[model samples]
Target: MKNITCIEDLRQIHKRRVPKAFFDYADRGSYAEETLRANRSDMERIKFRQRILVDVASRSLNTTILGEPAALPLILAPIGLTGMQHSDGEIHACRAAHAAGIPYTLSTMSICSIEDVASSVDKPFWFQLYVMKDRGFVKALIERAIAAKCSALVLTVDLQVIGQRHADIKNGMTVPPQWTLSKFIDFASKPSWVSGVLRGKRRTFGNLVDAMKGSNVNELSVWIASQFDQSLNWKDVEWIRSIWPGKLIIKGILDVADAKEAVKTGAQAMVVSNHGGRQLDGAPSSISVLPEIVQEVGGQTEILFDGGIRSGQDVMRALALGAKSCMIGRAYVHGLGAGGQDGVATAIDVISKELSTTMGLCGVNRIEDIDRRVLTDHLQTNAVSSPRN
Candidate 1:
C-alpha cells in the first residue's frame, strides 16, 4: 500500500492479482479499439500552460455535482460486473467513495444489488440504469432505486445495440465465470482472488436473481446479452424521468445533436462519453467531442466527462474544456482489483493529490478557475476539428 504511488501501479497490481478475464474486461476496448486508443491520445495532445510564482498558499478541490456538494468534481462511473473484480466489490467501492466524499454509481448489472449496496453503505450513492426490453422490470428497477434513496439516476443512452469486443468472446467471460481446466489452473495461480470470490456474498449477478431464477449459467448469460433493447429512444428517457423523481444524468452522448437532445430530456446533467471506447470503435473520442458539446449545451445542462481519465491532470483537462465534473471507470476498478476497499481509497487519494498539485502548477486555486486558459493556445485553436463537426 505504501509503495503504491500512481494509478498505473494499481493497474499493474490489478492485472497481476485478479484473473485474466476480469482484468481484461476492464482493460480491453471494443472491436479494433481505435476509439479506445483515441480517447487517451487526444487527451495527451492537449498541453497544460504552466505558471510560476503564483500565490502558493491555499488550494481547494471542492465542488458541487448535481446540486450537491462533493469533495471533488468526480464520480465513480458505473462498471458492470464490479463485484466480479473483487469480493462484494460494489459495496467496497461505494464505501471508499463515501469516505472520499464523492458519489459512487452502482451499475444495473452489478453483482451486489441496489438493496445489497444500500444496506452496506452509510450514504446514498447514484444508480446507473440500462433500459432493457422489459419495461415492467425497468420500472421495478427504478422503484427499487427510489426505495434505496439513490441521489441520482444515470440513464446510459448508448449501448442500445451492443458492440463486439473480441477479447470477451475469446476469454469466454460470464457471470460466476464458467470454469474449465485451464480456468481452474489460472484460478489456482491466484489463490487470493479465488478465495475472495468464493467467499463473496453472491457469485452470480445479485440484482438479477428474480429475472434469472431457475436458469443455468449459459441461459443466464444469453438472457443478459439479449436484454439490451435496440428500440431504446428518447421516449424511454421520458418514461424513466416520470418514475425517477431525482437528479437525472444522461450518459453516453458524443455528438452535439445528441447533447442538445439529452438536455431537452430535462436531465440535470449529461455525460460526454463514447462508452469508454467499448462501443462504436470508429467513433470520435469523448474528449475530442467535449468542447463542441459544451459549446452547444454547456449552459442548458451540466456536462460531465468520461473516457481515458486515469490521472488528476486528465480530470483537469476535461474541466478546462467545459466538463463541470468527471467520471472514472477503469482507474478505481484497478484499485479495487488490486487491494479492495483500501485500494480504492488509495486510487482516490492518488488522483486527488495529483489534481491538487496540477491545479497549483497551472496557477489555479479553485475548481471554478479552471477553463480554456489553462490549455496551450495550439490546442484551443485546433480543438474543433473533424470530430466536432
Candidate 2:
C-alpha cells in the first residue's frame, strides 16, 4: 500500500495474488497480439501541449454520463469473471465505484448476478449486455436489469463471435477453476486467491448457474459458445430499445459507418471501442480511429471512448478529441485483483488526482472546457477539431 502510486503498480501486485492462468486471461489479448499492443502504444503516441500562468490553482474533474452526475469523467467497464479475480469482486467494485461517484457496469457473464449487486448497493449502476442467440433468456435478463433499476443498458455490439485467445486455449480456463494436475500446480502458488474464492458466496457464473441446472463448466462453456449470435444485427437494437426504456449505450463501435448506424438506434451514447483489442486481432486501436468515428457522428450522438485508457492523461486526451466520457476495464481490474475493494477505490483515487493535475497543467478549469486546443497541432489535425455534444 505504501508503494502503490499507479495502476500498473497494482497490476504487478495482482499478478502475484491471482493464479497465472486467470491473470493471463485478463491481461492478454487475441491472436497475433497486434491490436493489443497497438492500443497502448497508439495512446502513448498522442502528444499534449502544456500551458501555464493561467490561474492554475482551481480545477474540476466533475462530469456526467447519460444524464447522471459523476465524480469524474470515468466509468468502470464490464469485465467477465471479475468475481473470480477476487471473491465477490463485482460487488466490491460496484460499492467502490458508487462511493466514488462513478458508474459501474455489471457484465452479463459476471460471477455475481445482477440481483447480487442491486441488493448490495444503494444507488443504481449500469449493466452491460451481450446479445445472445437465446433471445428468451436475453429478454429475461433485460427484465432483470429493469427490475433492479439499472441506470443504463450498454449493448455491446462486438463479440458476436468469440475471439480465439491463445492464452485461454493453453490455460484450459473455466468458470469455476478446475484443479487438474496442471491447474493444481498453478493454484497451489495462489493460496490467497483460493482461500478468498473458497469463502466467497458463489464460485461459478452466478447469473447462469441456476438457469443452467444440471450443467458443469464444460457444458456451460459449450452452451455459452453456442449462444453468441453470429447473425446479430441493428434490428436487435430496436428490439432492445423497445424493452429497455432507460438510457441505452451502444459499445464497441470502431468504424465511421458503425458510428452512424449506432446513432440511428436512438442510444443516448455510444462507446467508441475495439473490445480493448480483444476481438479482431488486427483491428486499429480504439484511440487511433476515435476522431474519425466522432467526426462522423459527433453532433448526432454523444461519444464515449474506451480501450487502452490506463491513465488520467489518456482520459483527458480522449475527452479533448471529442469523447464525452471514457470507460476503464483493465485498470480497475488490476485494483480488484490486487486488493479487493480498497484497491479499486485507490485506482479511482489515482486517476482522479491525475486527471485533475492534467487539466490544471493544460490551463483548463473544468472538464467541460477541455478541447483540441490542449493537443499538439499534429494531434489536432488527426483528432476531432471540436468538442463533442
Candidate No. with top lDDT: 1
lDDT of each: 0.91, 0.89
The CA lDDT at 311 in model 2 is 89
lDDT of 2 by residue, 209-259 (tens): 766799888899889889899999999999999999999999999988889
Enumerate clash totals for all models, in the order shown: 0, 0
lDDT for each residue of candidate 1 in 86-124, tens digit (9 for 90 to 100): 999999999999999999999998999999999998899
Candidate 2, residue 122: how far the Cα is off, in Å: 0.7
- Screening candidate 2 with a backbone cut-off below 3 angstroms (N, C-alpha, C), the clashing residue pairs are none
Ten-residue region with minimum lDDT total, candidate 2: 380-389
